[model samples]
Target: MVREIMEEGLLTSRYQLPPNETKPTSNGADGDGLTDNLNMPSQPAASSLTLVLVFCTFVAVCGSFSYGCSLGYSSPAETGIMEDLDLSLAEYSVFGSIITIGGMVGAILSGKIADLIGRKRAMWFSDVLCTVGWLAIAFAKNALWLDIGRLLIGLGVSIFCYVVPVYIAEIAPKSYRGSFASSNQLMTSSGFAIMFFVGTFISWRTLTMIGAIPCVVQIIGLFFIPESPRWLAKCGREKEFEASLKRLRGENSDISEEAAEIRDYIATLEQQTEASFLELFQRRYANALIVGVGLMLLQQLGGNSAVVYYTSRIFKESGISGSLGLQVLAVLQVPAATIGLLLMDRSGRRPLLLVSASGLCFSYFLQGLAFCFKELPNLKALTPPLALSSTLIAATAFTIGLGGIPWIIMSEIFPINVKAQAGSLVTLVNWSTAWIMTYSFNFMMDWSLAGTFFFFSGISGLTVLFVAKLVPETKERTLEEIQASITHFM
Candidate 1:
């Protein structure tokens, strides 16, 4: 029904490149679309060779991994914490659901903080918050402490989710930016998987402590990495911007052309009047906003959060051992993330999203079917395998596209003038929708397990149409060109 609603509006116009615009290809070196202009001669762009760029991205995504730890923690730790603390199901649910509330707050302020101090500083501040949150969790004596700690960690990771990807996109050379920016989600998946696996063996308190380690490592690592050059330029710190850009590009490579292009772009943006929320409503900004916010809405509403948040519970209900089920998921997500990283640049975003969302629709329908069959004595034998396959397929399908592309597209499509505002709005909606889904899933399942999944399946089905009709191919385009193409349609 949601698919039908969206199809009526979006299906009429197939996505087409602007008539005068030439589509950029990755056929040549420097093909990730960092050219001075479409008409300009091709310049040298090294392919993922700069150690500083690599290291910086690695450091930034440590925060992302920590963010994932916060997300996956509640699922495996749920049983242990409830037993150890002697908490009610209601209390534990509060502990689990409060993170998204914190996340909403963080999303609103992430852009301002990143712009105020710098990306590294914003990350450092987030790490400190996460450290405090984890310590609070580790030492909690009561339910209040747990909720507060969880909320703190949630807030920190909310900032990490927005700032980390944006930082990587700003600093990374266009050649492998897609793959590098994707490392944010890669580490996040790894974090969730590792936490679940480790939680199977360790206590909840010990897992909280383990979560702090990455933040500490990121804090130390941040000192060595240069600030984002685009940010520096945005701040009018011309010398620092040059130094940072050169550092990221490597000293031997020619940075002059790219530097000039960035400076010119920044200069043009600075000359424009400041953009407010009202300006975002202008006809020119319509397509970018729709695609950005629309993808985020689909990602969260499709039930990724509920699945991760209740993986162990779902498995247990299906007559599988929750511990072993979590272990399977621990092993499953990493390979899926690797596949996504490999295909991010190669296959492009739109095709992968369509495929992933279609798979999710099928997987969730299968899950609903499994639950439906559980009531029939004759088909009871099929429930376990069907449930297991559905879970694994859903996780894999989510990681392949919907898990990361929304954030990637959020960073790519918006022009610098509106990026902060647009990013915050998208991030807020993503977390808000996530909160509603995660908080409601348990009750919905109690009402009817099959109904809950059928709802998610419907949302997943709508996502395929959303991408096909609305999302532009952002594969190898420069950030400038991407904005241009999006605004062209508007």
Candidate 2:
């Protein structure tokens, strides 16, 4: 009987009722109370909700510190640490890549866990893993222990990244979705900036420990936020969903409109069969899977990871003295990322992606040219700073374009039936590519710096082409609409 009621309610609403359904007292006297309330937007009053979202975003995005510190501090300090530990470049690369490998494994596994246990719970699990990883790294005496610790931290970061955006998307209203979702990227940049600054002042061990601090706070914060309403509905927890919606939307606001939407979404999901990893290759979902994997792969191959992992080395190779140049580059990331957050909603996804890719490719090409002509008398004096600056520009552009988009698109592109599994598969690919790029870059640089920059430039150019040809613009589209479009492409 309950199932029949659910089906009837869902079909009547066509997967989401009009917001007007939330009229006070279920009467038309006030003419759709929820709609009237939503339309009556106030500036300073609305800012409170925005502030709450930003705080949640900050806590969720703190996961990036694990990735940022690992990339920034460890990449630059590897040579120094290797000298102390008597390790080879290959061994160091293996250790560095282990984190990505762990992330790949974790991302593949965490999605279903989040689906089953809820997004908030999954995040708490991540916090525990992050704390353990940091504690392990802090006290490590051998390279093996360091790798193990890194692997744990990577696992936490991967899970957190996968879950946070989904949670934000599920909770945010349609009007504010873009801004709220983009906050994840802003927080990631903040994490990177913090790590870079902290690494400059402290020992690598201390930096690692400090990076773990945010995860502790995140664990506490998770308890304060409501669980995702969509997840609650999926689990047949109608009462919980209704209560969560009220809290998220506010006490005075009616939730029937949003509740109806969740009911419809759940019903549509119920009509589909469960998805397996093998189904990712099936016709209905294959194109989306390809796009997801392609985006992840392109993001890494665009040279962001290489630049981030080797910022200090790149600066030193360019004949820039001391660590000051690296510090300046790190500081530059803050504003670049801020600009990205601002442009993301306004410029739309495809335009920003193409522009960012073009800029990245051009930056890499210029850096390659500078490296190639380092011996030229006239160019010699300016080669070092110019090359470093070009690389920084490339990194910033890539981060603005690809870093957050892949995660956001991956979370939304797949249908509800396959979302968890498909998102995990895409995230797995993302981490795997990160591992490959980070591991291969040192070897590529060893052969020739020019060769390395040229390789990445070629990849960035290819990414622009891919975006033009295959990737669809998803800005401001409903999840159902985006799914339908992808199905057509498939």
Candidate 3:
């Protein structure tokens, strides 16, 4: 429903910022065991954007590309599937919405799977499931087989939606971390765009095979990538942790400062009790939890998911050619995502999110007006162009910020002791809300086309305030600085 980009990852690294933008004071540990608080002298930041970091990120985001393929595949293949299988509207709706159910299931299991199996392994496993799912769809003759494939694909993608971003964060060079992280959307945009372009020329079955390629790519790519260093640190694999960090940082680089910081911080985390799901609600965690979960809630409620899954319908309803409109939408994603990559750290998360959300509000308002005009006897004749224009603006806004920043915020905000628990909670909320929004969208449109858009506009307007009030400016700060500010170990 997020169209693979909905309510998902965002941010940049320290690469583009000036050397002088550093904090005046150390944000180390509390009187607690956290060492960063001790004013420990900083080491030479590895300013190098090494090939290793880039390759690992590329591998991780192959999963993201596959995810986009999965999201985009549905729209292109929909007409063909319904015709071939003779699915009733209700049956097809299940195929359409079943991904969210699997996503919810994956969300529930994702944090635990990644934490238990290691990020790289989790990704490998997810790709396998996706590959199998695609194969099932490619060969399926009945609705049951199609649903099973779709369900498996959704389960796998929801995991990618979590691990790929987290994996990128862990390996990314702090300098351009946000930029590097933003590449997830870039590849996703690429996959989505490619699917739309090629689907017109290929059979639905052939499309399924194309969608499976990235899954295989990621599976192969995972072999070359190192396990997340933080994960290794968490697992007490000192040698492997250092090795992974060293590989990520570069072979010749001095890993001592970074290594010690990670070790000490993890040690600090080690002293804290691992929080259970219920324990995540404690007052100390209240702020971080609110930011993590609130962003996810508002992100979907803003109607990105609805607009995405039904864009073609929206176009057709406005009397535009749905195929032409979808192609146009496909054309817009890459450049928009590219703009997001360039701007993420330069603008900072809060500013970009504000601009993006505000842009969406404005766009959705325009769309509401378009629908309102459609209701007018005379003005109705001219509403199609307006609806198309407004939809494009909304899509662009979504790609740039609201689409991904919440995830960056989520990954950065949670303390290590409860990150897994927090991740499960945050991811679960995201997919669950997505399902609700996706499910209700058509009904809302039926009730009132103009009203439906106005409702979306209102939610997006509220999102602006929510982000402004609660979302922190993560920028180039270390994860320690972010968490410490929220939890205030003092």
The most accurate candidate by TM-score is 1
Count of backbone collisions in candidate 2: 0
Question: Which lDDT tens digits does candidate 1 get at residues 1-490?
Answer: 4643342223112233445777566564335443322433223544436888889999999999999899889998998899989999999999999999999999998877887788999999999999999999999988999999999998999899888988988887666888887788789999999899999999999999999999999999999999998889888899999999889888877788778867766776676577787776666678888998899999999999988898887897788889999999889999999999998888888888998999999999999999998999999889999999999999999998999888888888887777778888898999899999999999988999888899999999999998988887777656765665565442
Model 1, runs deviating above 4 Å: 1-48
Q: Give per-residue lDDT, candidate 3, residue 101.
A: 88
- Please give the range of 10 consecutive residues that has the lowest summed lDDT in model 1: 7-16
Worst 10 residues of 3 by lDDT: 7-16
Report how far off residue 489 is in candidate 3 (Å): 12
How many steric overlaps are in each model, in order?
0, 0, 20
Model 2: per-residue lDDT, tens digit, 1-490?
4654453343223423367564234342123221222221111223125445555666666665445555565754665568767788777767767878888889888788788888888888888888898888788777888788889988888898789888877777654565567777767777777766666666767777877887888888777778887888888898898988777776766667557755766677687556677765766666788888898889887767667766777777788853677577778777877887788767767777898888888898888888887867877877887787786777688668777877777767777677788878878877888888887877888898888888888988999998888777666544554564565452
What does each candidate score in C-alpha RMSD? 5.7, 6.8, 7.2
Error of 1 at 278 (Å): 2.6
TM-score of each: 0.92, 0.86, 0.91
Output the number of the lDDT-best candidate: 1
> What is candidate 3's lDDT per residue for 149-189, written digit by digit as tens?
99999899889888888888777655577888898888888
Off by over 4 Å in 3: 1-43, 488-490
Models ranked on TM-score = 1, 3, 2
In candidate 1, which residue pairs clash?
none
